[model samples]
Target: MLNHYRIMLVLCSSVLTLVGCTNEKAFERTQVEGVVTLDGAPVEQGVITFIPAGKGATAGANIESGKFVIPKEKGPSPGDYRVEIDSSVPTGNKILDTDGETMVDEYANAIPPKFNRLTELKVTLKNGNNQHLFDLEKE
Candidate 1:
């Protein structure tokens, strides 16, 4: 019984050491929120992504009723970010009968290609909470 206890104690100590060693430093992030509009109209449904201008995690949020909020925990650390917005709608129309009535989703770039695929909008975030409103135009 004593021998078994010694083995168990060693095993437990090893497991505890491994668990403690797994800790990694977590960085502070700025909370971000904003409204997205295109041509003076709110983007009804979509997603907004912020890619770090230099080196950092890419963060995103779902757009609902033209609003998006990125909590600090899930948002990127304070830095420059390029913004991209995209939205899609179901056309309720089939693509081709040859492919057994394949349905196609109608995708719209409400913010314009220049704002998404060719993003030109840049935002700077400071520590803590940050709020910014975006008014985009295709032209």
Candidate 2:
């Protein structure tokens, strides 16, 4: 009985030590949120992406809206990205008017327009919350 008790105590201590070591370090967390706009108007739909700052950084995507949010589990990092917006698609349609009057009817394409440089804003994230309001305009 004495020997069995000693073995159980040793096992319990080892388990406790392993569990404590597992939680030795905690990862820092950061968050980012902001609104995206163009020409003082809200951009309907767009895609927002994050590229990690340092070498071999990870990437994430958040769709475009009036607002966007990104969670940084790996703490704060630096990176460069190009934000883009999809403009309304262009559809080719022609209509004619009668009685000496000319009328033309047009429709937007089923596909949304794609802007390559809408989200091309450079930003940095440090220790806390980082917010950005992007107001893009056509050149």
Candidate 3:
């Protein structure tokens, strides 16, 4: 009976230590960078958000000169990531002519004008300095 108790205690301790090690490795922060290009041209003046694969912390960067560099944050768990843009423009009443100021179609909707669909780019971030370039196409 004493031998059985010792075996059980050892197994429980080993399992707990393994779980803690895995969690620490997962939540570690890392640097990530990338560029966004549309039709072979770098996208300028846009926000690129990185929504992680699961409940991981999100990160992003602002596009400049067709390039972007994400700040050091918690790295992803090595998987696919869906990319979306908050591409919305405000329609002001400061119109020049009636023809130019008309909301003919669904332009009045609150939905932002999507330059590209969500999930257009699937970025895979690893454990080191991650460099990626996304090229978009018209559907």
Candidate 4:
């Protein structure tokens, strides 16, 4: 019957549309690791972030003893990225807590603004494992 043929055609068209929509390829990831040092000494503790220069996901990792690792499963896609490093140190001053219940030691960013807020560091990631070392200076 004509109605039966029309129903079959509609079902086939719907199935083809769904299949076409699901065929997008996934983005590839690369493993990234690195060390951070300041004034020839290892940065004791810090955080590092990688922001894509164009279009991609941003990734970050915790720095412990100047070392950080971003596994492939959670790494960023290969591309250009701007690097930001942040670390904090006690300022030797006491400040009232936000709750005004107690005093807490004041802390300030140990790394220079050029390394974090207004970063100038950049890296180009490839399609495999990558290792980079960033040695920062005081001046």
Candidate 5:
């Protein structure tokens, strides 16, 4: 009788352990993809960041040829976020580096402040995939 009870207890413990080890994430994340365009032209290369409005993880992705994709594994949790997109263009000039060791190409942000520093862009990410298109205009 004691041996049977011990076996039952071991089985129950095993089941509990398995349940605890099941594939479950502590926080949920959703995939996000989008395109970034400036004045009707695709951005060649840039970076897009999502700053959570509330308590959540911030996510970002690289924009390549006007497309950006944040996979579900590295996506942000469902919430409101402030979007920031930035791209730089070479000024066709070279200047001395701050390190005072080499010359560096001068570059400037192609996107306006309205899309980054003083951004007016906002997005709400849901439980599923999210897609967005940003057509920014220069002021």
Candidate 6:
């Protein structure tokens, strides 16, 4: 009976070892750069974020001069990503002034919520240099 128990234990251990072996590769990231334009014009100011589908880290870059560059060291692993952009026009409508006033506030975001707060953009990143361009419309 003792021998029988030992054999069962060994079999179970071997099965567990084999089950742990998988062929999936580790997360791999590559450099990426892109331009963001709105209504045929370059975005003035905003941020672009790449949220991975899963099993990878999120990446983001500031939009400066209508362009953004994500370095390889700071970019997400190669995979599908959900893109989000937040754009705004400089010197937006002034309102809500300081000194407890309800005027002179400047928070004018041209892009709609569907593109930023509720984005619907998707992209597939491969294992090499990538350049993506986003053309957005205001609603």
Largest TM-score belongs to which candidate? 5
TM-score of each: 0.74, 0.54, 0.55, 0.81, 0.83, 0.69
The residue-by-residue lDDT of candidate 1 on 23-120, one tens digit each, is 36665577999898878888889999998998777899999988999998899879888988887766555465456676655544445677788889
Worst 10 residues of 4 by lDDT: 20-29
Measured with C-alpha atoms, the lDDT of residue 83 in candidate 5 is 93
Supply every candidate's count of residue pairs whose N, Cα or C atoms clash at under 3 angstroms: 0, 8, 0, 0, 0, 7
lDDT of 6 by residue, 41-119 (tens): 9987789999988778788999997899999988888889889898756465676667766776476677888787788
lDDT against the true structure, per candidate, is 0.83, 0.56, 0.61, 0.92, 0.92, 0.85
Give per-residue CA lDDT, model 4, range 94-133, as digits (tens). 9999999999999999999999989999999998999999
Q: Comparing candidate 1 with candidate 4, which one achieves the higher lDDT? A: 4
Residue 80, candidate 5: Cα error in Å is 1.0
Candidate that beats the other on TM-score, 5 or 6, i.e. the better one:
5
Q: Which residue ranges in model 4 land beyond 4 Å of their true spot? A: 1-26
TM-score rank order: 5, 4, 1, 6, 3, 2
Residue 93, candidate 6: how far off, in angstroms? 5.0
> Which ranges of candidate 5 are over 4 A from the true structure?
1-12, 15-26
Query: What is the alpha-carbon lDDT of model 2 when measured against the actual structure?
Result: 0.56
Tell me how many residue pairs clash in candidate 5: 0
Measure candidate 6: CA RMSD.
8.2
Evaluate residue 46 in candidate 4 and report its C-alpha lDDT on the 0 to 100 scale.
Answer: 95
Q: What's the C-alpha lDDT at position 9 in model 1?
A: 100
* lDDT for predicted candidate 3 compared with the true structure: 0.61
lDDT, residue 11, model 4: 100
- Itemize residue pairs with steric clashes in candidate 2: 46-64, 53-78, 83-118, 83-119, 83-120, 84-119, 86-113, 87-113
Ranking by lDDT: 4, 5, 6, 1, 3, 2
Worst 10 residues of 5 by lDDT: 19-28
